[model samples]
Target: MSITSAINLFRQLTVDESQVAHQGQPHVVNETCLDLLLIEMVQVLRTSVAETSFAVPHGGLPPSDSLELPQSSESTTARSNEEQERATELLYYKVERVGFRIGQRLAERYAKDRPRFTDTLDIVKFICKDIWIKLFHKQVDNLKTNHRGVYILQDNKFRWLLRMSGSEGVAHATQQAAPYLWFPCGVIRGILANLGVDSTVSVKETNLPQCAFQIKINRAV
Candidate 1:
């Protein structure tokens, strides 16, 4: 659903402010708090992954083969490459899991008063409008679906990336920024899962601050 439409719908569904206030004042926090937390989270996860990746097993004893001879340069490089790839994967997993739990909790809170969603499209629209606005302070810029089971959500100015930049070229900047999206991808999946949808969410960034999230519903058991 477009933001405008969503706003109208929200107005119709919303309760009076005075009534809501009687419950409690809405919680508010500095937006930068989340941004800073995310930055620290990624760094901490990366460090943990690196340490785990290189930690020695068997009480820190060197392998018997390592005592015999140094590995060839090619073999050593290959091993390093493998370790780096594994570390990256592990980092993504950790960050995404955090996001998944977050999304689940947020869904529980936000979906409390709403009527049960009618279908998959209804759920997706809720994410595009209410969820995005709640998290990012804006609705998704564009939402596209294949009328099958695939939906693409594009944000021209993703709040998380608005202030982020890289000294290197665009490609390097993109690579650096890629990990940040893993958490949100997990969040989307978590939200859907909580809403009774099974799906896989992935992201792509060709330009800074402009990214697309593709959510593919998993129909197979």
Candidate 2:
């Protein structure tokens, strides 16, 4: 079965968090945003992915001649702002762990479909196409390498980011969105790790819903 199908099944069979908690120690096995605060935090993080900052501002104020001034929610209290910032970090580590698990399982599953690879490039290609398609239902839009153990994979429509709604200014939107992308980032890292590739993985968003994962191989065994 495809990874996506497995995840969907997990979501379907999973009990509500409150119910699960009442039974015993709750373990999150599905990708569901449970907390209202996390929902907002995800929105903000998705916005930040689109823009550099949390809020964009008008030069001064919109001119009276303007038909309708765009609304912005840039101004926030210090404590709330700090809380969101901290939450964003927490979201990164949380999703990273989940993504890592997904990647490891996915790699193991995909490996059964093909012959053993002779080089790291083959595994990287699998991630760009096979693994990506399983997770996002689409292949990487672009792939590049420097021929020195550095590979770059770009997805024009990153699935997770596409689910997020756009916020006000570009800066704030991008910053908000940036944190949540860590899940996918961790997915890439985990996949490589399971393949016996020691690498440093990083992600960058050039635009909303489009991001790149860069992998620098440290050692392959």
Which has the greatest lDDT? 1
* Candidate 1, position 202, lDDT: 91
Tens digit per residue, CA lDDT, model 1, 1-221: 23233223322323335456686764444667667767777787788877776676223657536689766889877867766787888899988887777777667767878999989898889999988988887899999999899999999999888878889887888889888899889888988999999999999544788999999999976
Residue-pair clashes, model 2: 22
TM-score of each: 0.85, 0.60
- lDDT of the candidates, in the order given: 0.78, 0.65
Find the 10 residues in a row with the least total lDDT in model 1.
5-14
What lDDT would candidate 1 get against the real structure? 0.78
Error of 2 at 34 (Å): 13
Clashing pairs in 1: none
